[model samples]
Target: MKALILAGGKGTRLWPLSRELMPKQFVRFIDGESLFQKTVKRALLFSRPEELFVVTNRDYRFRVLDDLRELDVEVPTGNVLLEPVGRNTLPAIFWGMKTIQEMFGDSVVAVLPSDHLIDANEDYLTAFKRAERLAKNYLVAFGIKPTRPHTGYGYIKPGEAIEGGYRVEEFREKPDIETAKRYVEANYLWNSGMFALDTELFIDEVKRHAPEVYAAFENASTVGEAYVEVPDVSIDYGLMEKTEEAAVVPLNVYWNDLGSFDAIYDALEKDGNGNAIKVRGKNAYHLGIRSRDNLIMTERLTATVGVEDLIIIDTGDALLIARRGEGQRVREVYRQLKERNDERVLVHRTAYRPWGSYTVLEENDRYKIKRLTVLPGKKLSLQMHYHRSEHWVVVRGTARVAVGDREILLRPGESTFIPAGVRHRLENPGRIVLEVIETQIGEYLGEDDIVRFEDDFGREGDG
Candidate 1:
């Protein structure tokens, strides 16, 4: 069976850490491995790398490529489908299914999210076997056995047994605590955001139910064109709730969406005081006196006194302090910042580009300083800025710098300048990372206002 992974969500609930350029899937939170990597590793357990497809937005294309490359599990870059805009799950899944039909005709496909944690390795295999048997006549969805009265997830009620799975009786949204307890008492399973279906069968149902979406994809010549016209909706609202061929297979798996800080805290190993403390180095000390059930992640020594049920995340440029359960409401903070045109809401202190990454070390009204790291064998786009003039000093490795019309190779402690409106590009020809200190002197030194003459990553006028 082919595997389809959805990796395009903004993950606004996980703010301060998850930014526009880098979402939660790519960030390493629970363990050293990212959620996307974990999901890919899980996907590989059943399907080969060749049989996997990642559906994400154009903005996340490079991050996806970089993450997959780091894993050393190379798949065809073309298999990573780039959506022009996010139209939610319906279009994304439909596009993947259509592509699967073209590549491997009428095959069974499993749809999974890239940011969820599930360890049903054995149970998952069993569920897949059941799903394959049932997918001939039903669109099978995996349901998790609820451990508590969780109001964050939807509920799936299973009817009498039908071959390998049960007929789906009804689907319910997140209910009140009493209602959730009632659901648990009645043996309703938590709706796991996973589905296994026959590609041809799913397409047929979409054609019958979500014909507008079907028409959009069917008429377009390329994935980009299809994405431009596809209406933004979800599968549950468009097809699953309307179709008659729905079935649920009870999957006894350890699953958590990790949608909040509390969920993340629960997933991590806690200390003696029921706190999750992540220290930078062994020499650093975190003295938490009278603190309980808190999460403290920092790059330096962080001490918490008389604090409980809080989330303290320090990313150098931004520090977030919020009540434990209120982490999901961090979207409101993002919205407020966005309304005020704050860059902190969109980009992080350390912004990643295709060539490398840059961190805003310091900034002010007249000048701004940045620490730029260019990966070996990669070059920044040959571009020019209209408002800012830059001075670059090589700190670690050698840099091949192009300033205006003059080309020069600079070693450690070497410096160069590019006047405003002059074409320039930075390249690294060595085997190590090229670290440089860039100081900018300009009136308005925003990230925009750049004219690219050439680019290697095909990123221009897109962001």
Candidate 2:
């Protein structure tokens, strides 16, 4: 069986932690392992590493590689399909299916979203086996038995009982409170967005229904062909709901989408007072006073008094304070920020790089200070900025710097300057992480001012 991981969602509801560049799947919000890593590990339960494929945006290609490298899983480099633009689940899944068919032929394929949390170990394995058996005639969708009257999730009503599953009666969208309560009492299951199907069967069904999307991929001559002809639609809307071959596999797994702060609180380890605290380093501390339920995460000390059912998140760059149950509307904040073209709506203070990472230390109107960490044997792209001049001071290890046309090695206490429009690069050749303090002086200090002439990670324009 081959597995396709959908890892391209922006996850706007999980703002402050999840951004456009760093979505929830890549964030280590739960435990030390990222949700993407956990999803990859889960995929390994039914398939080999060589059979796994990741569908993500072009911007996250390097981040995905870095995360996979952390787990030491070497997926086929070309198998990681990078979309030039996101067209939701329909295009992404169809593209992955086409690629899989071209490479592995018509086989059993499982589609899994990277951002969900599920605990059914043995049950899921058994369900996969059952779904594989049913895939000969139906498109199997794993449906979680609703534990509560959740109005946020879509409901799947079962029709007739089959050998391994049931016929999907209908697909219902997120309903009102009364509707949700009635459905839950009637034994409706929450749509898990998980499916297992025969590749050719799914493709044929998709072509029969959503011919526009199928035709876009079918006419492509190469794997590098852009899926621009496809519309922005979800698999649920484009194919699943319209197909008569849909089957619902009952899954009694402890599943949560964690799409909102309340869902995150529910999935976390709560204290005796019913509170969940997530700390980054040793400096994080939370004190709840007369509070029964809450989530508080901070970089330093946080004291809550007389506040209950709340979410208080304090990152160095931003702060979020919201009522617990009302946390689902946080996407509105993201939308407002985007309308204003705020960078905070997209990236974090600590930006990720292919080689390592860099954090914004301080910034002024004309100057910006940054603390950069370069991993050993890693190098930044050979690039230049037209609008900014940069000064780099090596604080630790050693930096192999390329300034203008000259190449020099700098150790501790040594510094170098690259004038504006001068091509330069930073490299760490030693066995230790190279720490450097970069000071930039420019009229425009945005990240898009760089023009990369060459990059090892295939990033020629942006780092």
The C-alpha RMSD in Å for every predicted model, in order, reads 1.7, 1.4
TM per candidate: 0.96, 0.97
Query: What's the TM for model 1?
Result: 0.96
**Residue-wise C-alpha lDDT for candidate 2, range 1-463, written one tens digit per residue:** 9999999999999889889999999998888888999999999898898999999999899888998999999999878999988899989998888889889999889999999988857888988889989988999999998888998899999999999999999999999999999999999999999999788999999999999888887787753564667778999989989999999898877999989999999899999988899877586788778887898877777888888889988877899999988888999999999999999877888888889999999999999999999999999999999889999999999999998889999999999999999999999999999999999999989999989998988889753
Q: In model 2, where do residues sit more than 4 Å from their true spots?
A: 222-226
Tens digit of lDDT per residue, candidate 1, span 1-463?
8899999998877777778778889888677888999989888878899999999988899888988988998988868998888999999999998888899899888899999988957888898889988987888888999999987789998998898789998888889889999999999999888899899899999999999899999999977788788898888889888899999998998899988777777778899889987665456657888999998877667888899999988766678899888877888987887889888867777888888899898999978999999999999998998888999999999999998889999999999999998999999999999999999999989888788888998865512
Worst 10 residues of 2 by lDDT: 221-230
What would the TM-score be for candidate 2 when compared with the true structure? 0.97
Error of 1 at 39 (Å): 0.8
Predicted model with the maximum TM-score:
2
CA lDDT, candidate 2, residue 76: 99
